[model samples]
Target: MTMESAKLPDGPMSGLVASAVEYMVDAGQRNVLFLDIMRKRGDQYREHVAQTAPHVLQYAAELVIDGRKLAEPVNYALVRIVPPEGVEIDKNRRPFVVVDPRAGHGPGIGGFKADSEIGVAMKAGHPCYFIGFLPDPMPGQTIERIARAEAIFIEKVISLHPDADGKPCVIGNCQAGWAVMILASLRPELFGPLIIAGAPLAYWAGVHGKYPMRYSGGLLGGSWLTALTSDLGAGKFDGAWLVQNFENQNPSNTLWTKQYNVYSKVDTEADRYLEFERWWGGHVNLNAEEIQFIVDELFVGNNLAAGKIEMSDGRKVDLRNIRSPIVVFCSEGDNITPPQQALHWIPECYADVDEIRAYGQTIVYTVHQTVGHLGIFVSGGVAKKEHAEFSSNIDLIDILPPGLYEATFEAKGEETASSDLVVGHWVMRCEARTLDDIRAMGGNSPEDERRFATAKRVSEINLTAYQKLVQPWVKAMATPQMAEWAHKMHPLRLQYELFSSENPYMATVKSLAEKAAEERKPVSQDNPFLAFQEQMSKQIVHALDSWRDSQEAMSEALFLGIYGSPALQAAVGIDPKSTPSARREMPPEHRAMLEKRISELRSRIEDGGLREAALRALLYIGSARGMVDERSIEALRQIRDEQGGARMTLPEFKMLVREQFFILLLDQGAALAAIPNMLPDDLNVRREAFRAMRRVLSASEDITGEREKRLRQIAGMFGDAVEEGDRESNVAPFDSKAKAS
Candidate 1:
């Protein structure tokens, strides 16, 4: 065979020529279609911003309660997140209230689709409400004022749903996570279960090399820039800066990947891309005081979670005041609020497990293996899996005794059926976890903590200096026109304006794109040029990522170099040798103050009636294994739902469990001693309570080992022996207690 024949193969040249021509034309048209849609996407964003920035939310909503109309006016408003067709909400069910982050963008990401937080809640038959804000803050809307307004909103919701099982289950996303936490603390009775997703409470946390956002405050010259920015904005800080900061963290995603994604699959990707961009581009504003307080008190001072923040009315914003069960959802891949930052607050705020248990605080957390910060809230799969599981099982979670737990989720085995559980699939179990487990996740480096401590002092000095020296002059020159012009000129906003039809150059692109679509062709997957194009795009993203990493390393170094110095610590009155960063010694008076309460608890071990005894016994058996699952939670809920005996509200039930658990902890012997009096004189009554108690104990699957022993001890209380240790006791038998009622 000739060499030319070998290279060309034996196929006819016409087929190859035709395929090549087709591929070229397809690639060209596809490229044109991509550009065409890109122009239109830009136009959509422009239009969306012009007419209500958060037009991305697909669910229709109606104003339920306006905060401005309240006695204390604020920008926040409570709106009922009306579900889409095919989903029905029950008013008698526990309400689910979702609060979107106000970090930069406008609201509505939570209900961005049918498969979002709101969607999952609605699908679970939860009455849903959304706490949203306006683009412009009220003249003087402080964070405290907003929290009060939200509390009022929650009050309104609760009053509207008197027949509901319990208070609303509040879910806060990102910045809103901390905001709702603040609300929960101020008005703990207003909530049932609190879910904080990707919320960074411990601002100064994370492992140095792995997480970089923690270094931002120090690297940006402490938080004086925040004050300066607000001043320059004529007392209103533009939210665009915060959005720009997020974009700067991952330029690959911001500058290239987002646009490139739409460019590559323009035909299919435009709607989704534009939908997200609408929410992303809708920037909001913060009053100078609001932004300044966030920067000075949170990011810079890190005081809220520390229990040091004093509210306007002199009430301390202590996290311990949050009585609602808190479920923290975070991710390892979340650069914005990494697991370290999200989870470390527990360790910082509480000395140990004993302290957490002492307060009867139910804290449950789950860390996603690889989802990013945004994915925690925005990903549909997460809504279906994690959130679905959460919403469905919140009732079970509410009844759990106060303690720390790590929520474990796993796909059900093949034998599992759709009818067996909530969401018909995933199995969730809460296993007890220790503070050590969280600290092991790089909770807070001693060195880094000290650096933040030093930075906090430096921040105060710089902020005061800025207010006195830089503020007056900047405020004098800054005007309403300049602020308006500056807001319009943001790079992110300008990009959209440049590509929309508002710019004359983009006028023909949409029409041309539509024309090309009629004759559109798509390139074959193996086309050499297409392959090359993908490789080049990957290289661009990779280079940008590498540059980002380098910048992160540089920022961390600069932060530590200035703030980590012994000199700086000394200058700031920090004696690292004597004073630890977060583990400072409790003042003698403070310790003494709690001692009385502790002593009272220790002394008052034997107390309460049948309700206390039953609740105590339930907690004792379930917690003996230090892990719990909802295998029998359905029965438990049915039991709670049933109007049998003295019906306990969720809070009352929780209190009984807590009071009993603490009593048991203080003096198990005394608790046992008090048990006989706790039960009824009637054997039939005792029998019924015993049967109910056993049902509760058997809810968890792990009824072995220590649990087996506890079960035997508890079974004895039924006045019958199930095993050797289960000797008949003062309590009546199961049949008698249950049958009597």
Candidate 2:
């Protein structure tokens, strides 16, 4: 071989060396950029912390009512959102108020983005308002005061839109959900329709092995630690502790995956990560009385669902008292607030479906298959779909019959029927449901209930012991300066403070990162080293996840073992062999009210003319399918709009619908027979009412199956004939002999 031939082999080796050197240089630059992003994040956190009232809301807003100025003061305030350019508000439409949860973080997650709860409502032409709070609680503030303040804010919104077609719609996200429920229960007359997203009302309710947060109280010896922590904070609990608990739930994400993703995609991911961190790092404070009541009554004691929570005024907070329609939005993939926690409250509060209707309440709940807890409120996709559908169909939900219903959505496509009727990319349908359906979603057995009850008892004992033993000394030792120092030293805060410019070491990172950005040379996507780096990152995530699983398993086993012991049950004054009671007896006054309402409805069963006849016919047709569709509702709205004469307000419409539903529910055959009497004597009026009913039935699709039979029967009662296509009609003819004269 010649020397030139030998040199050719060196050429390939040198090329490989050059590629490796280039990759290393790019990797070094990326490191600098990543660190700089972290520095900026830290700086953002510091700035957010320093603000008097920091929120992540992307919209400009004007303060409407300050809760601090209410007769009962609180830190919360209600603000009206000013629509951006090109967005118009319809003052005649129902207004919307979005309340963010005050759990750990500062408020604004509901309006964190342009495509959020507030955004969707505004896009749908509703005047929007937001309820947010300051970073610190007022001294001696309590949960009851905050709820009262919210009621005042809602009253203000109602007054602002006196000419609105309906009362204002209220949406509460997470912790705010339960707060809204409490307020609605206390003052249901002030609300129109309520949407609660990712709220946990039944705290002790959860599927075994899936929800770990519920077990934390048990493993930590109940709420004694909560009280201890409050005392240590000088009567104010640092919300960073709550945020830390949330972080601890997912070790892999918190310890590695989150930071690694930003580092790997630093060029594109920095702004998004910093935006989220600004809200995540902004911790707030809650009064000791507030946190204690939350942990004691709602979390550990599980009193809210049972109607055992009495206010300082001696009035009990019973969820059954709420008169407004409630729409519950939960998700299966939410580890923080699982479906069981969100929905089991219904069965806990009401004994059966009949009881639900007895109270004349409409409850519609939707469960997402895969979105996590935060995604329910934070994801743009969810906001555009579920929130949008709810906003556009708020009136439809409000007018639904008093019963249990499950709302589901499907994507709109060419195959979708009545696509024109759908407002956006999805179609919503609500099917009548039962208490048994809610129970089938999975919950604790009698044994599991006993265990939880025992845990609650133990928590009470521990809390009492702590109050008598350790609380006094801790309160005596705690000072404002000491509390402030402890808060600054929290791990969650330390991470931001250390990486920020406040640290002398991070100063050079900005200049280095700028230089790297100016001379950016990114490595190829197919680089072998880059692939290797990704694989290593995956391994790290897997290890951290494994560690988390092990820790959770251990905690679960310990909690169950301790709480499930017969001896422990005996010690806690609970009988291990007895089943836990899940139902509460109806108060006599509520029972009497329901009886009087039923009698009133029965007396009006044979009343009214064209409107009542049309509604009764629609309800009869809808019963055969056991479901309600938005398209049919839109058809009704169109009829009302196009007629442009003697329109019924939403409240009147709701009352008519509910009245007709109860009539049918009381006596289906008698109600059907009375349809002819309810119709006007004029032939043209009768024909128009029948056509309107048919239009609603055929709005979504061609009437077929059981629904078709029911519709034909209705047409026959109207003295009209419906054509059947080359087939013998199975629809039973209306018996003229039984018709009302």
Candidate 3:
């Protein structure tokens, strides 16, 4: 990152040698400066460690529940975020509960800065709570216990906000996302709109050569490695190993790019580098039971996506049981949890979009073009746009009829929000998206899935063998002191100790570095030798990247060759070649329920009050558009609020919206035929209801095409409700005074 200079002029040969000599002199100074900064960083690192043990959270918090006191103790606590000054918080708004991943790192990245998940929610006037864990897991604490504790924490948040508009809006980052979904499926009554960012839901999904984390299980001989590691730690696996695996995913960054960036700009980059390293180095530990379950059931088995995961009480966890609306945020640049892993669960849970709609589920997702895994949660721009928009419009997401949609954030010029006239910089619009949209992104490779299925079976065999053979011996040899020593000796942890002033040999380096700062000399941007050094550095990084790529390719080839063979497929109880699945007819009981419901709807098609008629008509308009935007919903909300007819509770209205949408889906003609039942003989009253429909349909600046045609069709269904003069001048959509009434 050096400044550019004019092209080198053709000059005398000796001049080149002189410039090289100056470049060497500058290089020597930078080397000395870098060493000094490193020593200072070591001192800072030691001080940081001394002050912040067990956990590091930027925002101050007061614990509400200590899981250790529970019947099944975990090293987790539910805390309330105390928003700093200048942030407005509304206790009446839906509570936001953010859970950071327990995957190797300390908690609080969700709100470590002013522009974060919690930060965005609080900015939108939400009461924010966080689920943070201590450094060590409680003895024998399992992922199931943690999941239950998280649910309890959410329940407490919901109890504190009983007067809020809806249930708590839950956010789960990375590995925490699956736990969030588990809680939602188990206790769907306690949650609201869910936001799961960069979490791997479909663990066995990925296009070949694109995502290789799934392949590591088979390559490493399955979950035995997890068992061995856990046994070595004396029933508590050090999380630094997890952190090292993540770093190994991209060697260029871990070994070259990140360090080079710091070294090249050590003068300004030290503070930022140290800040990130603090979180990276503060590793937590998981109990043997927890890691084993994670690997056996989730990462290796991929059972969550299959709805085959079972709790200790024998209750099966099904994603389709989750009644809350879900908004998934993923990035194409995220190698860890690509869009495939983040969103493929939708297709796994539902055979088609109609099934999703039949179950009354709303799912919306946005795929960022380029942002790494952590960037999905920690990037300020993502927080400002996607997270902010989600908080402000989550209530609207709840009212949306069952369907799949892709939400897009469009940059806006100065415009007022629905309330308080706050100038907004983004307009979020929901676009019509189908299941195929997700399938394409999911890489839809049945062949790859077959290989993973083999791996899962093989892992089960290996894990059982290890537990019966090697595990007992390993556990016998493992002691508390040995475990502690192993954790300290981990390469990820050892780096900190190597630089720490706690070591007696390097005590004088601090004073030496501080004094060297005074003699700092930076190299010229255009020095010939500096250019040569940068070129060589790039070449080395490229070589390492190439080597990593070749290794992965070889591993993948071996994995496919082994697991894709006919013999292994037979061993795993599968055909080597994938066959098309035959669709079965609906079960008799389920079919009976569907038939009875359809018969009931048909019988009552013409028998409801005008209130039903209005709701049915409104739902029709929303469905015809193939998408719903914030503007449309805001208009509908105002209309519902201002109607002069019989009023209904919010929950009652929600049920009506869902039922009418389904009735329309059942038979569009029958649903339209029943619109007159919703209107009375009084012409003026009919006109007002139609006017409400007109306003809701035209919530945007304008409405045209199929929506306009549908409006005319509905107007014709109203018979004489539309007068000749009314047809000539349609109601203006966004007139403030009209909306206010």
| Highest-scoring model, lDDT | 2
At residue 343, what lDDT does model 2 achieve?
93
Tens digits of lDDT, candidate 1, 1-741: 886665543466755665677767876777777776667767877777677425466788989988778787888889987777888888778999999899999988888878899998899999998988888888878988898888888898999899998889999999999989987888888889999999989888788786777777877777889988887798999999999888887889988998888777867887788778778888899999998888887887888778788887898887877878899999998988999879888987788877776566889999999998889999999999999989988877887777789999878775442224334478788999889889888765567678888888888888888888888899999999998999888898888788877777676777777888897777777766678789999999999999989988888788878888898789888876544556434456656766776787776666677667777777776666777776557646666667367777766766666667777877787787677667777776666666666655544342456766775676666553233322433233233323232
Clashing pairs for model 2 are none
lDDT for each of the candidates? 0.79, 0.88, 0.79
Error of 3 at 735 (Å): 3.5
Off by over 4 Å in 3: 1-26, 40-53, 414-423, 442-444, 577-611, 638-652, 680-685, 718-725, 730-741
- TM-scores for every predicted model: 0.90, 0.96, 0.91
* Superposed Cα deviation of residue 15, candidate 3 (Å): 6.0
Per residue, candidate 2 scores C-alpha lDDT tens digits across 1-741 of: 887666423676876766787789888999999989889988999889888889999999999888788777899999999999999998899999999999999989988998999899999999999999998998769999998888889999999998998998999999999999999999999999999999999998887677889988888888999998898889999999999988999999999988999988878998899989988998999999999999989988889999999998899999999999999999999999999999999999898888898888899999999998899999999999999999999988999999899999989997776677788788899999998898899998888888888888888999999999999899999998998899889999999988999888888988999999999998888777788899999999899988988888888888888889999999888898998887788889988987887788778777888788889988988878888999889978988898997888888888889889998888888788888888777777777666667777777666688887787677777773333421243232222211111
Q: What value of lDDT does candidate 3 attain over all alpha carbons?
A: 0.79
- At residue 581, candidate 1 shows an lDDT of 50
Which one wins by TM-score: 1 or 2? 2
Per-model clash counts, in order, read: 10, 0, 1
Q: Which stretches of candidate 2 lie over 4 Å from their true place?
A: 1-16, 720-741
